[model samples]
Target: MNKPIGDLHCHPSFKPCNNPDISDIWTYKKNIHPKDLFKGILGVSPRRWMVNLFVKDLATYTQSNLDSCYEGDNRLLFLSIYPIERQFLRPDRPFASSTFVQRFILAQVFGIELKRHIDSRIIQILTGFSSTKVVDYLKSVYDSEYVDYFKTDFSLEYKYINQSHLSCSPNAEDNVATFQLVSNYEEYAALRNQNIIAGILTVEGAHALGEYNSKDLVGDKMIDDLSEENKEKLKASFIRNISALKDKEQFEFTPFFITFAHHFNNLLTGHAKSFGEAKNKSMPGFSNVFNQKNGLDLGISDFGKQLIKSHLLSRHNGQRILIDTKHMSLQARNDYAAIVKALRDEGDAMPIVISHTAINGISTRAKAAERLDTNQLDKKSYVSRWDINITDEDIREVFDSNGIIGVCMHDGRMPGGKFKDLLKSYKKRWPQKEFISKLHTQMFLTNVFHIVKVNLDHIRTLNAQIPIEENRIPEVQAWKTICLGSDNDGIVDPFDNFNTASTLKDFKTRVKNAIDMNFDPLWKRFKILDIKEENYRFFNENEITELKLGLTSEEIVDRIFSDNIETFLSTYFVRAYLEGTEN
Candidate 1:
């Protein structure tokens, strides 16, 4: 096993599984063999299959299961507690037509593989039925009136996290590798010293605040269109949920951050297009069904702004939870950025956060959109140009705010140079060993490389305004902003080579090896920007030379894997902003 590393965002319990103990994470073997399949089909229906001919959004095997995390040496993780948005379940248009169609969409949305079946208890609970049959569950979904289970789901997750903590026996005879939630740096440090993994709670979307209602009415209703009484009720629910989160007596800890927007509009703020075109290409029938682009043009709602100001970003029990800009629409991001700036101007220590994202390599939101309009996938660039990703302007903002960015490991979002085409080619050459590995690893490295470049460029621009005699920003400072936001078990198609949290140990090694093999060629290629590529290059010869001088390959890799996150937490995850008061 390799040394433990940190992950900015992952979900260890989003999948449907049966763990009776509740304190222990369920572990399963890959039993997708023909014999197992035959037995499963005859005895019980399998939820997972070798391939889903109908739906492309197949379930990935457990990526960050506690067993995998313990094995992969992922010691510190910020678990994204997402209450699966209702829009995803409801879908739209064609998907709502037939029962089989509903089942197929449900399988895809829930990430259930054919060889595996969702735990009967879970299915029953989701559908509100006593029968453990899939048909019954579907019937319940279609027949039952709308009911928002967001709060129920959120509370259940808390139970899982808390019980999982209680289950950890780090000092037992087996010395079982396990984790505990750490609210403060001191607790994290203590856990580290004991060789126990640390988990930090983070909410994935503001929608998790509460959205109780029928799937039909609440999934797509804009706040403005809702009746005044309904709007007030929703607001009350949101506030009640927010207050519950602040009740330390119940939750025992505060979430470090809450992402304001996600796949669908929460009526609080709009969201960027989450289900990209590339992903839509996989599920031919469900093209653009999940993204809900109608709300993409909407900015932060008046109510959303108030909640962020009065509840989320405001101090609660002396701990102010930050906001993560991972899935916010450009307009919402802009609005939030201005709010952050204003807060900072008033002497607040708010740090900008973009958890689980890729770099688009474009300078600004408008330019990225222009590039996307012509080149839908932005394959010409070294990284994906999807607007869901962070732009050069976003990177600059992160740097200026002394904030942090978690580079996601999702392949769909980290595309480089006709990445889907490459994947197709790689699939054709399947039996060939290391071919796919080399391809995906390169894609991941490009994202990391571009992030470093963006940070370096930001510093270079700042240095240009100063005297030559003044100390230039050390190039190594560029590495500090990045941490691994793998989005493991978050329904992401991770790098094939680094598929699971267990593989991240190998990922660290691969990163070092990839850097050693490809650094020079990549550096040169990036310097000469093609017409197709955005104007992302901002460093000169002297700056490059200084970067080489300041950090060794080993040092840079180490920072990405663990040290950078530790450093970020040391400064930001403290008792207060006052110096020497981190404890």
Candidate 2:
């Protein structure tokens, strides 16, 4: 049996449907239906057939949905708690508009049935709603009543797992797996010991904090232009928002990390350049949306720096929640790293994390800029320049801080320049169909394989850079930094073969196969990389031990899939608590 897998980042709550009872809609997919008759003849369930056929939303995908976690044997997940931005739901979007033609298009494209009560006037009101109003609406959803309902419903529907439990209780049935939300390393270990699926809570965007509008104002305005009274109000609102997030009883949620920025510019920090029509065109209201003017190319503002110092960097009740650097602009990332380094110099060990990301081999701004100047940038290098991916410098910083980086599975981030070529081939072969059958799966597998190889190469590169005799960081230590964090249900274009969470099981097999085929050749190439012999002058006894236990391909796969991140959490969180740094 394969070792249990953990996704360091995913969003199960970001559903396409506006229905309050979204859980019911997901549950309904599991119910046997009359439509299963034809599928039954082919030994496939109707739900499975539909999922493999027409379902494009990540929420409906097997591994992404709550029920499918058990089926897929994905025993651990970092559930990203997010409040949808109002921009995507604006009434001007074709699907959100109420005209008969627009409604018809919506139904045809997304299979959403429009009701008569939802007319153009209602949509206009919703679209015109302020970000403040949207924040209030989301707050209600996270309130106790809704939180309790969500927890209870999931637990009742999936009897083997109890969503409300923070630690595992032994099950009388051998096959049953308990699911629990872990707040710290101890709780995580306790659940894992009993074969539980641990769910670690994280926030996708700080915009969910309800200070978006105020933050935006502060970002855009000069202090001289704003009234003292208004500035005071903004300050108060920011504090209140932070207080509410820390209020575990009222919200029933506390995040381990909050991604400082996302697709849009949040008031707190400047976002990375994640904008493009090709990426957002499929979503309603997002066709022409871009992040260029709204905090793009900007770094953290004065207010943002203070906000981080007071909330994220400061301990509350003896605990500090780290900030994730996934969506921050390159300047913002550099600013954040400098701040963290300053703190470390002052005897603080605040670690840095890229919760979900891919690597671009370029380590410095000079190198990246030179590649861009010559128009010789690889896809990954271009992506890194855009700040959507990590650079070698960032990876090294993460390693120095003893922080883990979760490898994202989104096709855009994954290595390989084959997707465009594959698309061309598919379009030529099957002009009448949107995609050539089975080709998506093949391309997805190929992309995943390339991702694995690139990550391994990154590890080797880091190893080569380190002074060999100093710590002589074992190749395994670098390998331990890589782990799965498939951004499913996070508005990601998932790899085609591993399109949904449920498909992760098959991906594990493919990973193993790819390793078998590519590991030795890659190792040979790594061994030949030019390095100064002085780095290995005084190799120590401990270094010799690690070198002898040289990681096997299977062991590396196991670490990436399960052991590494688990170890990271245990070491980081447990140390935080023991050192009196955690609340």
lDDT of 2 by residue, 330-410 (tens): 778888988889888987777777888865545553354343211123322212233466666676677667777777776
Candidate with top lDDT is 1
In model 2, which regions exceed 4 Å deviation? 16-18, 24-63, 91-175, 212-230, 247-253, 278-287, 290-292, 365-385, 412-418, 423-471, 519-549, 575-583
lDDT (CA) per prediction: 0.66, 0.52
Q: After superposing candidate 1 on the true structure, give the runs of residues whose Cα lies further than 4 Å from its correct spot.
A: 1-3, 16-23, 26-51, 54-59, 95-150, 169-175, 215-221, 278-291, 316-318, 371-375, 379-382, 467-473, 519-549, 577-583
Error of 2 at 469 (Å): 3.6
**Superposing every Cα of model 2 onto the true structure, what RMSD results?**
10.0
Error of 1 at 215 (Å): 6.0
